[model samples]
Target: MSFRTALVLLTLLCALIWWQATRPVGAPATPSRSGITTSAASSRCPMPPRTERGAMPLQTDVPAGMSLQAIGETNLRPLAGFSIEARVLGREDYRIGHEADISPIDLALGWGRMTEDAVISQLDIRQSSRWYRYSWKDTPPIPVEEIVRSSANMHMIPADDAVAAALRRIERGQRVRVDGWLVEANTNNGWRWRSSLTREDSGGGACELVYVCSITRE
Candidate 1:
């Protein structure tokens, strides 16, 4: 063949070979209507099914709320910036086991006493201008002489409506004892710990507000 013809033929052959080698193989005759569709993927390994629910999810980082009915003689440490005292009210079916999940009490009780041997409402304590008297007339006010002169002592500040009601009981001089978590008393943050407390006393059931106070036990 002539040199010019031979060179032309060789170029054509190379182009054809390159085109053929780059062509797709085993692909659908036509492009998929959905475009580049991919197959559903399976996980690399099988996962086990979830087993069960754990114990009640109350915060382990903070003290759990208790009720007056459950009060017993146990040594308790004074919470920083807070104080704790106990008085004998009565016995209660405190759920030492799965009581919360099973027979949950209508409310918690027995953390404080109105007197040396009485359980009073936590609400009453906060309400008593004599014992509490923090805010009045929209701004802080000096307590009257009777409150300052009275032997009544201070109790945990209510963190929520429930706690407020409990304190109110003490304010009214109703005998009450309540168990609760001790926390920094912030009016803004108190809602998280307030609880509606109920107790069967004086042959009748009563309901009131209680605050959850923090406690530490070994």
Candidate 2:
């Protein structure tokens, strides 16, 4: 190819890259375009009322999967319509990693008896490398089985910048209500990330992949 032609092509390529990098993923003003502002959060540990605590997340079946194409050729297939009011037991953010390309945050959430201060006080919670773990010195505070069923590590895929901002501001010990969908992402390159359909399971592959449409805090 001629040098002049190659230089022009290279300049166009650089311009395209810059535009893609600078574009907003979603703007706060246009949240309605993505979904409803259904989820929210607040700062720090003064717990929600008992009435707002202690309930299992609600998941509605989507018979056809409700698959939606997103992030290039990746198809985010909705496994169910999911909503949960729970305590933020832990929060982890990923900015530079393969997983961060899609889900940028992971929340360690607890509900049911796990939301009780009496129970929470007895446990030590920590999140690292996308895992949520809890422990208590001396005797166990509650049945290990109940703990397993009541808590989970969830991957959050913000539907828009509005959701992203809210999710980023969430703090541990705050009550959170998130409305969204359980999803499985499949890329054209055969990469896959799936959400666990059951809370009863634990260990690897147990985390929920949540595409958040709305979040609420405080």
Candidate 3:
């Protein structure tokens, strides 16, 4: 091949890689029930009531047959599991397993009015594992603290390839339903991570460590 042709090919390759890395992702794939196992005979559990804080509604329901299972471990704790349904404010994927293969995507999730595009459009949101930041041009429609409390940065660990692929497809500004568990992990080296049961809190140790068995965009 001519040197010119080789150089052009290399340039194109570089551009493609950059695009892949920086392009915005779309919503998650359609829901698939193929691998999901849930109890149809049992009655559906009631959704949790909205908090008085007036934050966005985050309803967590423990379906009749739903239960927690162990997927990975840390030095001091074993990552337990739960189910969650919320709006995707933002998402960040890890190419390298910073916390090992146990977790991959850092999902910024919100619900209720926070899910409304009209409301969210006024604010700018960004997410990393267990951390999220927001900004707005004018005064926010709702209280900033309310938005923060209504949303959470979840460290998601897919239980299988199907769940992983579904998560990978999720993009910002999409609503998602996730079924799994809230887990805690501990390593002998003193490193530990755990899921926070409440959304009203923030800062260190507040992120949910989830082992996702099934996930779908709504």
Best by lDDT: 2
RMSD list, candidates in order: 26.3, 10.9, 13.5
lDDT digits (tens) for residues 77-153 of candidate 2: 87877778899998999988657988889999998898889999999999998899999999779999999999999
* Candidate that scores best on TM-score: 2
Count clashing residue pairs per candidate: 44, 9, 14
Q: Write the per-residue lDDT of candidate 3 for residues 73-118, one digit (tens) a residue.
A: 4422223334456788888877675474678789998876777788
Q: Rate the local accuracy (lDDT) of all candidates.
A: 0.28, 0.79, 0.65
Candidate 2 C-alpha error for residue 211, in Å: 0.6
Q: Which stretches of candidate 2 lie over 4 Å from their true place?
A: 1-54, 63-65
TM-score of 1: 0.20
* Minimal lDDT window, size 10, model 1: 38-47
TM-scores, in order shown?
0.20, 0.75, 0.64
Worst 10 residues of 2 by lDDT: 41-50
